[model samples]
Target: MKTPLSRLGNSGLETSLLGLGTVKFGRNAGVKYPSAFELPDDKSLASLLSLAADLGINVLDTAPAYGSSEERLGQLLKGQRHDWIISTKTGETFDGKNSAFDFSAEATRQSVERSLKRLKTDYLDIVMVHSDGNDLELIERNEVIATLDQLKQEGKIRQTGFSGKTLEGALAALKQVDMLMLTYNLREHREGEAIDQANHLGKGVYIKKAFASGHLVSGSGEEGQLSSFRHILGKAGISSIIVGTINPDHLKQNVRALCQASAGMV
Candidate 1:
């Protein structure tokens, strides 16, 4: 069966229930430990994206903070841009030297413009306010929301969201965001109530670290532990789970687990 595509809040954009995270594509920084998987350059990245598209995964999530990920995705997916739903983030500036938060209205506008140039797209399906689970006050400020609203009007972003680490941040953002991205695996269900609230409000919810930073997946030293956690998320009402892997076989395995979870076979 074809995977279902659902609307994000009242936005006209529809995305698959699963998304691909590109945080590892261009660079790896701030991660607690270095990844053993060989990082893909431009060509390999394109091939992987093509594979993902063939597998019925439509939503691709990337960010400026992810090294050269956004630029690489732009170069690789330029031809197939219309074939997928592309979601990216803003609210921060990266100079290859240091990164700093900038949620002001002007900064947000400039960020989206830069994203458009980097993605080589006229518009984005969704643009999230990239947050580190802190900065509640900045996120709630009228300037940021107003700028996002303006971008929505200009057709630069179809919908806006916030990627938060805390339930309180998510809750505070629910009033203005069309969707939310959070860490919501079996072990991190502290946002259960927030997920319920979003679902009730008809806002889309996207899960990150669903595998607990590869802990739930096999070969990460934590196997068989994910089944129960997967069960919990499937039953708890999550919209989509974004997991990253470098191996094609492992990607297929992840998809299988997702299929099983969707079929209530987990």
Candidate 2:
């Protein structure tokens, strides 16, 4: 069965119930996955993208902190750019060794421009602020959000979002941005307030870490994954869950779990 689609609030963006996270496309260092793996080759990534499309997954979440993800997507996603809803971010970048954050207006603008070039797109569907745990500071920074607002006005970006760590910042972001990217799973619901607020306010909500960085789903097998998917999707305000996987077989199984979960819920 095909995955279901949801309107990302009033942002004019529609996404699948499951979105692809591209961290594995570029960088594997400093990640929290249960296992480490090599970066996928172009052919491997091409097959994965094709598989994602076939499985009805349309949303992709990436960031500068994700190493070369944006650039790889730019080249790999070249001919089929319009077919997917590209979601990227500013404020943070990951060198092979360390990460850096810059939410200034100049850096933010430069980041978005660089992302556009790296992603090889004229207009980005969604651009979010990649937080560095200082959620409140970034939300209230004014310069960053204001810069995003300006970019949206100029048609460089269609929607703005915040991938933050704190509930306070997430809640505040709903008032300012088009959507909120959060970490929500059976083990973590601290952002419940922000999720509820986004629902009430008609803002989009995207979930990360729903699989506990792959520990939750992979160990439990298909039934375990189904349970995890059901648990997250069962939540009221969730627009999509971003799951990162480099294995094609795992992607197929994940989508199957989602299909089964949705069916059972009905």
lDDT of each: 0.72, 0.88
Q: Which is the leading candidate under TM-score?
A: 2
- Model 2 Cα displacement at 134 (Å)? 1.1
Q: How do the residues 1-266 of candidate 2 rate in per-residue lDDT, one tens digit apiece?
A: 56777779776777898889999999989998998799989999999999999999999999988989999999999889999999999999888988999999999999999999999999999999999999997777648999999999999999999999989889888888989999888888899778888888889999999888988876676877888888876767678889998898888888888878777442
Residues 1-266, candidate 1, lDDT per residue (tens digit)? 33444455445566666678887886665553234554676677777777777777888888887778788888888678898777788876556566788788887888888889998999988888888546477776637767888899988888788887788888888888888887777677776677888878888777787777776555553344347335545544455667766556656566655565556431
* Pairs of colliding residues, candidate 1: none
The estimated TM-scores of all candidates read 0.89, 0.97
Error of 1 at 114 (Å): 0.5
Model 1, stretches more than 4 Å misplaced?
A: 1-12, 95-98, 218-229, 235-237, 264-266
Q: Candidate 2 clashing pairs?
A: none
Query: What local lDDT does model 1 show for residue 13?
Result: 60
Clash totals for all candidate models: 0, 0
